[model samples]
Target: MSIDAFVIGIFFVTIHLLANELIPADRIKRLRWLSFSGGLAVSYVFVYVLPSLHREQHQLKDYASTFTMESELYFIGLLGLLLFYGIENSVSYAQAKGFAEYHAFFWLQVGFFAFYNMLIAYTVMASEIKGVQAVFYGAAIGLHFIAVAHDLWRKDPDRYRKVGRYVLASGIFVGWGIGTSLQLSSVMQSLIFAFISGAMILNVLKNELPKERDAHFPTFAFAIISYTSVTLALKYFFEW
Candidate 1:
């Protein structure tokens, strides 16, 4: 567990550095990789995370009696979706209304995503999911993080370069530190994973489905179909 946490934590921070500081955005775009990466992310969320979340709901059945554990956990995922949607769109609305001067929206984004990263870090570090499953999930998230770091930098290059980058990058490690040191109860852990799963859906789609962005459909399609197929095949073959 410690080794997994350490590897994920260190690798996440390293990717942020590459995405935010080391690489030029145009060259990054020219790589034409985000779509395929986004597809892998969406595939994992749909094919793996969502199922795990549902199973987790069952695990919490004994403790929560008011509502079906399934519904409650799904609600957590929905709440995550709405919260991030508001955070992202609110910033855009503020910027569009000539309110960029306030900079509050920008900072709000920072705070929300810092927490977002921490949530994911906590979930990944502490969850029982391991081996190939863990690798698939982690790879998808690593790609997703690059998109996020790139977006934050684009939003306010000066601020992100000056301070925001480091702040966001550190969030993963902070969450890992907390998660490793403390074990959350089963229900709480399940809820948190559901929330992160929801957030991942929103983050990946918002970046990939933008109308203004040029998309490589073939690459994207290939990623989704192939990864999904591989995951399915793995399940059937390994009976995992």
Candidate 2:
């Protein structure tokens, strides 16, 4: 595995642990949006801008070094954190104002964004693969979506609101299966996966958010497990 991949994987795992287990829930709500936004800015600088700068400096061979900055993975991670903060705050505000249904879609939107960006990050990291590797990758992604679906199923009543998420998950699973069967190029597979994942997250955030807080811990656990499982699965699949 490339240094970039290794670093990214580690960063994901660390953050997942921190956000899910280490960080106190009370403090999480108090987290500032600026902190997340600053992280996003740093991520953009490292993942997107740094590589280009390094390439210009004729240090293209150190691409892995540039890529391993945790920016790519953390971009969406911080975004999800921000969204979570936003939803919680919005919900609290709405409740204070007696607008229960006003920001009900906030939670749903957060879930969708998290799932979607996670898929994109996964695809971005998935640069090469063979048969079993592809299957494992697909399965890992499918499982994450399944987690999201389970969360949705347990929460909302609006059937129509959940439809898009389900469709997005199913589409990616099917696309991944087909891509694996046909032995598609890494770039093609990644692009297709990224597109679907981005679309799902974007649409869900734009549409609605979820309300219930009972599933927060489970959702956090699922995300951490998903990240770890996918990394281990990918490593094994590649026989690395």
Best by TM-score, which number? 1
Best by lDDT: 1
How many backbone collisions does model 2 have?
Answer: 9
lDDT of 1 by residue, 1-240 (tens): 556667778888888766755557866664347667667777877888878887877777687665553588888989999999998888988888888453899988988888889988888887745677667667778878888888888888888878787788888878888788888987788888889878878887777543336667777788899999988998888765
Task: Compose the digit string of candidate 2's lDDT tens values, residues 1-240.
Answer: 444444444434333223323433334442232233222322333333334333333432345664455244334344544655565456456657776674455455544445554454455355544455444443343333333343343344344244534444343444333423345554344334434433434323332222233224344444445545555565567643
CA lDDT of every candidate: 0.79, 0.41
User: Root-mean-square deviation of each candidate, in angstroms?
Assistant: 2.2, 12.7
Segments of candidate 1 deviating more than 4 angstroms: 21-23, 29-31, 64-69, 100-102, 210-213, 238-240
Instruction: Give per-residue lDDT, candidate 2, residue 198.
Output: 35
